[model samples]
Target: MSSYEENYLARRPEYLCHMCGKCCRVVTTSIPYKELKKRSQKGEKGASDFLSLFEPYESIEVARKVDAAVVDNIINRLIDDGNYNEEEITFYCCKYLGDDNLCSRYHTRLTLCRHCPSSPWSIVPPGCGFEGWLFWQREQEKQKVRLLKEELIELELLKHRTSDSQMLDKIDSVQSKIRKNINLYKRYGSENW
Candidate 1:
């Protein structure tokens, strides 16, 4: 992980949670339900662990009935990101969340549960404490990618100045690695940066 990512994990503000239970009451995954089940059957720990704790609501409307604001917040965010797909969206609720919004299995919850809002892109409820932090993390990531792109441009310039086969090969390898890092963020539109 980059230093930015390492710092993000290290500085996560778990204390900032409002304990409203909105996150536990309404949730969704990037992967659809059927794909998650397939990955679970394939012995993927993340898929199985998430499935073990969260049960899918019958439909989006059902999830809305549970918490209209949270549901609409997630839906609007997805739409704004151009990732809205009704067929792919499946809301879920954690079975361990008590009526009071506390985790009944807090002591024995899985790592997945313990790491709620794990990523900068994690879809959290409106008014979530992680909102500002996640946004900062995302900006950090974009800045990193932009720096890598600048490095790539300088590397390209170096290629024109070199005729040594060995040096050219090494530069190509470095460029490949840098490109792989940039490609990882293409879903977030890193190419534009």
Candidate 2:
């Protein structure tokens, strides 16, 4: 087997995705119309057009029939953190997901599809492909944060020796933003953000 296939086999103990595509049929992410227009202009019409194909849910409970536990968990977390609104809790899915579990716009599918529930660290359906990817992504992110922290320490030492207060403040602010973003990713998992 190719190294990639071999690696996947070695790491993934159970690959039970039947590709029934129920998850795809039932769940979706919504983007604002302005953002959709921008993406369409950039040749991402599938995502832009997706906004027109689905209706929004009124509540997390309504969204739950599709995947209530996952949806509730995400919504509750975001709400607790003050990052989400009640109106934004609406769930959606494309109208083009046919009875045969195929997307009419499969070729031009959005980033949501590429990193759907099956993607790493997501609360995908049971037996999805997220478990292995989540572990790998966490390890990679930890390594990245460690490296960035080291760089920030070095920059701090340099800042202490220099009298450029403005430059020092800028560097400190930037580093703080990076650390905050890293922490956000760590806390929420890459998929949720």
Candidate 3:
């Protein structure tokens, strides 16, 4: 589970979604849907889990017109990262969304759908109530990344002071370790963090 999911569940486990169905209308992934399907066919766990619950939008332009937030926030962010290829970015919607932006399976929604848009960087609708929450989540992640970088600098100094090769090697390994934590927020532009 993500730290956000764990912490939030510990504090507020009861699911309290606004039910805008905008999250249902706008789903995306770093990889193209075709590749996702291919990965699913190859028994990739993440691809299988996501595809089993969501279905791709039949018309990209139509989906864009229906809710430009996904296009603006998600697609544009991918473009800025130099990963722009409209065909490579697919939008999706939860198959369970019913009329008037309600979840058809409100009582037994998938856990993933329950905590959908698990982070602030997720492409939610413009007016979705989680806007402030998302901002706070991003700030938390940014701060964590900054702290990791700080520890990395200390590790760099420790490496120079150590004569033991094993200890020096541990410092290198820890740098990689810290980077793994930092990369979790790289999608939110944590490079500067």
Candidate 4:
């Protein structure tokens, strides 16, 4: 099964899309559009993949026409997140989305579109079908962080109690990477979670 399908089975029931197409019609990102464009120009893979499939709406009003609630939800979430600078947040829509809420180039849709809602925390339209899935994913993440915290404590104790410098160095490296991974959720208040 595809990773998305696997996630559906593992967490929520068989996933069912409401077909509002709000996700494809309106999308936003913490990454600014200008920076994405610059990175695409510089041949960055993620940026290039994004710009390849999605283009900016001619203006915010144009995006609003496509799905105002989705657009407004994204903007409001970004504002509330507190980590994002107001000007640095950006939104875009798939040019391939059709009036019937179908993808014009479904077979050839880019990976970014195919694998959208990249995480549980992705801000989607208010009533998207993935809402329950997202909530389950967040709870899964919290459990993971809790486990990592326990592991980190053990690693710290091992490092200090052992005189093997090489082993201690390895332990330190593992701890560092784990902390880095955890911090990705820190913006969601992982520290307090």
lDDT tens readout by residue for model 3, 18-85 = 76788777878888888888999999888898898788877678678878865677777677788778
- Residue-wise C-alpha lDDT for candidate 4, range 27-89, written one tens digit per residue: 866678998889989999889988876777777778788778887787777768765564665
Please give each candidate's TM-score.
0.88, 0.54, 0.75, 0.75
Badly placed stretches (over 4 Å) of model 2 are 1-23, 28-47, 100-105, 108-112, 115-127, 158-193
Score each candidate by Cα lDDT. Answer: 0.90, 0.61, 0.76, 0.79
> Could you tally the backbone clashes for each prediction?
0, 1, 0, 0
Candidate order by lDDT, highest to lowest? 1, 4, 3, 2
lDDT of 2: 0.61
Give the Å shift of residue 158 in candidate 1.
1.4
Per-residue lDDT over 1-193 for candidate 2, one digit per residue giving the tens place of the 0 to 100 score: 6563454444454444556665664453445445655787887868655666665555567768867655766666566756676554456666767777777777877655643543334545444555456667657766776777777788778888888889988888988887786676665444343
Please give the lDDT score at residue 16 for candidate 2.
Answer: 44
Off by over 4 Å in 4: 1-14, 83-86, 151-181
Q: What C-alpha lDDT does candidate 1 achieve relative to the native structure?
A: 0.90
